[model samples]
Target chain A: MRVVLVAGTTATAKIPEISAAGADPTLVGHTPSADAEIIEYGDTVRSPVTPVSPTGCPTPAAITRAVRELTGFDVLTVDAGLAKPTAAPTIDVGARPGRDIREPEPVPTAPGAFEAARRMGLALPEDELVIGETVPGGTTTALAVFRALGETFPVSSSLPSNPTSLKEDVVAEALESAGLSPGDAAHKPKLATRYVGDPVLPVVAGLTVGALESGSDVTLGGGTQLLAASALARHAGAAGDLTLATTSYLADDVPELESAAAELDVDLVVTDPGFETTPLDRYAAGEAKEGAGMGGALMLADRMGVVDDVEAATLDVLSRLDPQAVDGVEDGP
Target chain B: MRVVLVAGTTATAKIPEISAAGADPTLVGHTPSADAEIIEYGDTVRSPVTPVSPTGCPTPAAITRAVRELTGFDVLTVDAGLAKPTAAPTIDVGARPGRDIREPEPVPTAPGAFEAARRMGLALPEDELVIGETVPGGTTTALAVFRALGETFPVSSSLPSNPTSLKEDVVAEALESAGLSPGDAAHKPKLATRYVGDPVLPVVAGLTVGALESGSDVTLGGGTQLLAASALARHAGAAGDLTLATTSYLADDVPELESAAAELDVDLVVTDPGFETTPLDRYAAGEAKEGAGMGGALMLADRMGVVDDVEAATLDVLSRLDPQAVDGVEDGP
Candidate 1:
């Protein structure tokens, strides 16, 4: 079965605009909770609100739900850490939501969560594994982690504007607060996560390492955060058939993505999602680029030879959410 | 894959001698933690202490370790509730450790845990599920749950001299404290768990019911707790090929067990465990009567035709724990 880790970080709360995974800043805390429910139950019945962009772009869980309906590739949500716990059934990795990265120790649960998630990865029952994440503001953590390890690539953003200056300011203050210099933790990948990274970084990294070591073909799903995980696994000496998969939306936005994949020495596959005259056309227009494993779920649909059905299935899922919302989409001539 | 749920309760501390699942009352809270670790890692590597009786009879996790070593049947621990959490990798069912049943509401987490576990059950990926639980002082809670639900089966205890009267007094007072009488929750099994039962009860019940409804063959393992789960499932209108599997150790003590199985309309399978001339022969002497899914693991080992190898494995595992302790057992000859 494939796994998507739903997590939270106070970084989203600190810079609410840094993430649009939820409808609002306060709901950002519940995005992981709502995303977990969508992955598990195909609806947000357990959560008080749905995970949608402030402007109403569907959470990637809608695409994930479409994949579940079509391909039947087993999927489960692993709760790495969350400020607000999900009402969906999830595999807990012994973590709690981390504080904003400016704190001395942003993720105190790092070591234990890494170890726990590693064991979880080692015991994965499937021949193929897709490790994904749904942490809002995770790319900011990825950027900080990359800086800590002395990587120079700029990470992509969920928002249209890259928000590079703001992310850089956040990461700069964080690195300074944690008394860390670039390349100081190049040899100790775990140290980066303990200091300035969010909880999802170490967890996704551990799962990738363990699953790869167990000889399962693993795909790290999502964009910059997954790149961060692959880099961590690479530095930690975990080796196997590993792939970092994400959407062209990210690749289109971040010019350095291909070179970053090359520097990590891992296979990287970029997907287009192929939505036509649908609400998801926003993906290509640089709105809500990727989160909640959308890129990986789309790739799986392609592999299962059911890619043609995903867009329709996604629209159907969105219609179920609110018919008027789907009806509100404009049809281009 | 077989699943064992490890949980904790405040009930064990309320009347210390009422349980011997741990080495002492203080260790009782850690029993589930230790048991979960033992099952996951084949030793108490993640736990601060081992799960042993007050006099040092091993926890049933030893036998489970033997089964894991011998039969190669997959085993995983699901955490239902733990006052002190285990460091071992576990599936969380979203419940917290419950209070002593004498309180107004012993298990406030019951409803959510039940719903979460039922979702867990329905999503079960394995074909044959052996659902077991390890909760210290569970028998007393089982007695209260059964009384509240109008069942009259006497439960088994870990100690050689069953603390029957103490259990009865505790249950009687708990029933009264909750403003409930006998049969008060006959049709509301969930209510019994909320008011007087432990967290493990509702979780196990939900797993059994959801697994059963999903058409996965399920065997409820352990003594009275499994029976209580089956009874709850039956009363809740969940039906499928279901069996309550326990050890002859429990059958040897509780005479009404067969009648209870008959009343629940579920097939009952009792195994001998066959530990003759081995350290585990203490099982026959009734030291620790069927817990940590020992009966279910034994039954699986027997089904896999590795029952003969299990005895030697148990000895090996025990010797590894402490060679001196294994040598202390007297030779039967």
Candidate 2:
């Protein structure tokens, strides 16, 4: 059996404006909840707003749901930390929503969430495991963690124009707030996640460790966020078959992603899904690059010979979500 | 992989004195949590009290822990409902602690918890699943559910004197409080769980259904409580490879248990574990009949050729818990 775990976090509050994963800055907090709901139930179950980018491009949850419908892998939502409660039935790993990355203690509940998720992961029967995350402004937290861990990489974003300098500025303030230098968390890797990382990082890292211990081949199913998780896993003394799966959009946006995975001793699998030639080609044009396990779902679909089905299913979903989008044909991607 | 899921419930508050599963009434709610802790982490992590019967007999968790150590199956705790929080990492299914079974509405959160647990169960990889429970006063609720579903049998207790009449009276009151008559829930099994059953019953029943759907061999891992879960599954229109696993003590106490499983079209497996000749023979003597998946753990251990290791490890656990009991060497059990 193949399992996809989509986790939510709230540390995105620091750079919500820069994130286009939702319609508005306030709606960014609900992006993970909506993404999780969209995958688990085939549509947004409870949230008033649909999960989409600022220009009305669908979140990758729609694509993940499309692949899930085409294939048969199970999806489980993990409430790592989300501002709004999800309508889908979820595994609650964290006790509280995340604080801003610039706070003295951004994720005080991370250790507990990580341990709980680790326990759950350790018990999973051996199979294919995919860990994904949805924190609207998580790239900033990812950058903060990378800088704290003494790694150099500008994280990619869902927005068309990557806000590299803004993320760097946020990480600077976060390091100062947490009383840390750039390389402080290199030896003490947990300190990066404790002080500046989002709730999703620790949970994904812990699950990666435990899932590896269970002899299951794990796929870290996001962009730089998952790379940070791999770093944490390696630092925590866990070693096994670890594969980082993402999309071509992210690879094209951040050229250093491949080298980062290579430095962490993790393999990478990037799926194109032919979105560039399909109706959802804006994905190739960089409108919501990846979130909600999109890259991993497409990779699994590719292995199952159903990757060709994602485009039509995703188109049908978008049509139902907003009939006018498809009715106007070339008006919207 | 083989999985043991231990769940806690709080519906036994009204009949606490009749239950010997804990040292005191208040401590009963902690039994399942402590049992989960023992099996998951090898000891009770947080609760101040040790989970033992009134006569200082070790709870079945000690045996379950020993079985886990010998045969490396994983153990998970599900917080169905408990007054005090558990120290072990848990997948919290239910929202609130249970109310008295003899209330107008006993388990209002049953439906939500059932759905959440079902979602989780459906995602489990194909594996052997053992579902167990700890509810100090669960027998009454089980009897009530049995009566509501038109089955007749005296429920067994942890105490040597089975307290059949007291349990019967409690069930009668519970049925009256729920405004239900005998066989009222025959075609409406969920109603019985909602009105007359404890929190664990719905979660166990829901998990049973989804796990069965997931193509795993499912084992209900306690005595009559698990029987109630099986009945709920049958009434909920779920059918698959179902096995009712219990101890010889329960089989001897409830002569109709085998017939009840036969009527439910479920197979029954009773494990003896040779406790009569071991230092922990009090289990055979009915000091603590069965809970914490003891029978299922023993069955797994027997298959793995480690059933004989349980007695010695149980004795060691008991000795560490209360050294005076084992020092005299023949005074306790």
Candidate 3:
């Protein structure tokens, strides 16, 4: 099956204090996203000066890259709001980084961003499009987008121990600054995103709308960020083919996601990467749940009957990411 | 031929007092460009409040729109930097309106714009592309781009009166603000565009590069603006089938265009548009000389063997624009 994987990075990822998206804070300085792209291009993402994040265990890019290798899908990287230039050739959206959500205009170019995203969406092949993103503090911004879109629910993060309270506090302040109440975001998604959402949200929303409007099957790849986009798409009166494909990690997150999917009438395609018994056991243990289009990429693999290859590659990638973890695991059949 | 017409409007057009783009200042305010799109869509451009510029006689949109009707070419409008949203379904590049060139960073998002335009260019059908534009005040910004690109040459304006002195003044101030000398622009096209060029230049250049790289014959429609784009494409290492298509209106304003074309080793495709003895006499009279991708649209019509239809339609559109001028001309054969 022909599929296009879209990756976008946003600065909101850096603000989440204990983001499990990287091995450490220093590795979080745009390296993870950049490394993710390099890995997807089948290149060793190692730089002497840059501390590359281990893709296998904590970040979704490594897993997504493995999925690409297993599934052999076409990938396109988009710099929706990357603070730094990436290592690979990326379709730069030319959007600025989102300011701290506390500001009233975190993404001042939100409307224009939709236009850019729509253009990208229109440019794609007329096949099912799997849209993914790799913003470091994406979950926080996802939560903000969700809340801004009037979804009053908590979201999962890269941290094994989700910082639900901190995220809630951040979203509250952002909503307040935007002069929005609980249900206000649904009415003006563009304005809400401009005031509080990260750069990727509006873009993803636009991509979804553009693809759907043009009659293509679209799977929003990620967890709540896509959910926010799904909400925006529905709010924008989009009546196209759309599904939310994610990992079982998010399916287990349940509650908010289930209600959101039901409300939006979006089909769900969740996959179990079977990382529990492998070296990448942390994902089963609930660390680094989803990013870099991992969920959708894995779903495509599962659909193509290459889930076993995906699982093996995930372990191999994890081995490269964390050599010490290799000693801890037994060989698989 | 399946062709796409990319039109970008810049706020810079509003600055020129006597633009060759329109007969009056009020007509210049986005109407000329918008009318071009409307005519291309095969509709009358009459809005009492909007002061629609006569596309047939003055700007090329009327002429190009006529060509589209005769040949049924696929048209895609691009909003590279429109001051206002267009009436049609445009492939919005999500670019901001360009600030006056006097600013140090007039088109700040130029590099990102290349990425956007390149994506649009790459998405088009694998056929010869006749890309056109309809930005008002595009000439002054074109002059700035040419000068910034290190070319010591003059550019044509939409006004028959040729506001060369005024354009030179604006460009001088812009170049000074950008801290650039002659020949600096060739080395730094993006930087030069950012400092002084309008939003359309980089986009068109990117579109040209994208189409050329993808192994397609590309004809940059319009006059000096496209010349500036050609220079940027060459500087960016575009080694592909490229040609510059414009009207005799611009060819008559030759010298600088000829030198620039010769320097770029680009072929020139100049169509007389036969406005001399036609009801579009004012165009021959040099009132509103070129704009709205009229020149390229005419060339494409000529290439397709429909120049007569284009001319007849130009007169028809002109009559709709200014009925008083219709009484002065004989009926078409």
Candidate 4:
């Protein structure tokens, strides 16, 4: 499967007055979630992290690691916009992190991003494209995009407990500050993204359009952020079949996502990694359920007939990585 | 050989008052020869070109084509800084093209470039690295870098006829403008690149240093531009063995290159494509003799025991691409 992993950041994450309710407090504090994911993706087991939880949570990079080990597919990371530099070889789309949704025009690189994505599409190999994303504070922007598209969907959050109320309040405040209501989103799909969305939204929409034009099946990966991309693609008159894939956690958490996908004419594909059976506490707790292309990667592994193999591989990796568990057992005796 | 091909542009190329006597007038007119080289390297024939000459001249990309076709090695193109977007998947270093050499700082990205290159190094495969570059007006900047390193070597030019005098004049004016003379270039190598060089130089130096530190044998590719990199790598106290490789065209054209290599303690390897045997007018005319990692690609192909195969493949490609030559024979019948 051809994969396009888009990464970006929202300065909304840095809003001092905004709720510290989106991403994991630890990763978001040190670096943008995109950078943290990328760093983990590159150096799988021993990546640097400031663990807020006593036992560090399993990074979604585990899924990427599984895909690499089982299928040997390279993950192409796209920097739609980011505040920090990625260690991976990233495709820079000339974008910057969106500062405040209240500013009205947040993603300044929206038009250029669309063109870059279209150009990227013209270069991809002939295969169904699995497009995914990793962006902190994406859900709020996704909510804005959804409302603009007239979908009253409850978006999922990176946090274990969905911060739906907090996200709604922030989006509401941003729209009011920008002098835009949900109805103003009418025909201008791009306008919503420019006013309230993160840098990755318009660019991913462009990628979807470009891939569809190239006659490739497209999969919008991740949760509400991808749903936002689906809405933009539909409004852009995308012709090819489009599917939205996510983790069971995101699908199960975001209550209205099913109807939103139906309204956008996107087929839904959800992967159940059965992290419930795993020894990893984070996946069980739903702390970092899906981002950095984890859901799509799992789906691709399943298609490659190595879903079981990938799961085992991920377990082996995480087992080796969690020093506290190994040390505790060794020292106890 | 694992190859890292770095490409960039200098605004110095667009200086109307500056002699258009550096790069091939034909290829540089249409595209950054670097981008053109990347396209040709990816696809051996039928790559885009604007035919300024009735039959286009042979590009250094021919060397890259020969190596890839013969040895099946991968080419990694690094966008240190570029004026135009490349069709290939480039590792962007987040650099802007130099505005003017007369400005105190020509390449503002030098410090950041060094860091980026080092990071790139950390990510590269643990293998011998073949580092090559393609930058328009690179030789003049090479002269500047060399001068900053306190070397008085006359650099090579891409023009069929070497415009050493004009380049010397330009370098002199630039050095004077930057308020720097040869002696001030002592221990700080990055200083020279910042004052007068283009964006690609420092990054390549960092790549060289990183590869060396990784215990990989490194080969600096192309002509004077690489010599400048060698100077930086040396000053940076590079530990690994380095060999500067280029075409006989560059080695023969530049008088002081041999001594410069000796001073920098880099072993020099030169390849002869033997264009004299071919009926192609441009090859015989010696236009665009070396750049785009051509000479190093040739060396790698030779090491793979396919130099003759690559030469034959190149002739076949050039013959198929040159329309007038094909048309002349077809019309004669």
Model number with the top DockQ: 4
Give candidate 2's total backbone clashes: 0
Better of 1 and 2 by TM-score: 1
Candidate 2 lDDT, tens digit per residue, A51-149?
Answer: 777777778888888888787565556777767856554556654677888888888887887787777677554476888888877778888888888
The digit string of per-residue lDDT tens for model 3 on B62-166 reads 677677767666555566765543434344455667887887888877889887778657645446877776667777888888777777667776554677788
In candidate 2, which residue ranges exceed 4 Å CA deviation? A1-8, A11-94, A99-139, A142-164, A171-197, A200-333, B14-16, B316-333
Model 3 chain B scores worst on lDDT over the 10 consecutive residues at B44-53
Error of 3 at A61 (Å): 1.7
Candidate 1 TM-score over all chains jointly: 0.66
Show the lowest summed lDDT stretch of 10 residues, model 1 chain B: B324-333
Provide the TM-score of chain B versus the true chain B for each model in turn.
0.95, 0.94, 0.88, 0.87
Model 1 misplaced regions, further than 4 Å: A1-79, A83-95, A98-140, A148-196, A202-333, B71-76, B91-94, B125-127, B319-333
Cα deviation of A63 in candidate 1 (Å)? 17
Q: Quote the lDDT for A45 in model 1.
A: 46
The best candidate by TM-score is 4
Give each prediction's DockQ, rounded to 2 decimals: 0.10, 0.06, 0.03, 0.18
Q: Write model 3 residue lDDT over A1-333, tens digit each, in one string.
A: 333344444455556473665556655656444554444444332222222234335456667778776765655555566655443434445566777777778888789878777766764544678887766676777788777676765677766677888888888888888788776777677877788887877888888888887787899878887887888888778887789988898878755687778778898888898877766666776766776787888888888898878767865665565443343333211
Instruction: List, in the given order, the native-contact fraction of each candidate.
Output: 0.05, 0.00, 0.00, 0.16
Task: Give lDDT per model, in order.
Answer: 0.77, 0.77, 0.67, 0.68
Report the candidate with higher DockQ, 1 versus 3. Answer: 1
Residue A231, candidate 1: Cα error in Å is: 8.9
Clashing residue pairs in candidate 4, if any?
A: none
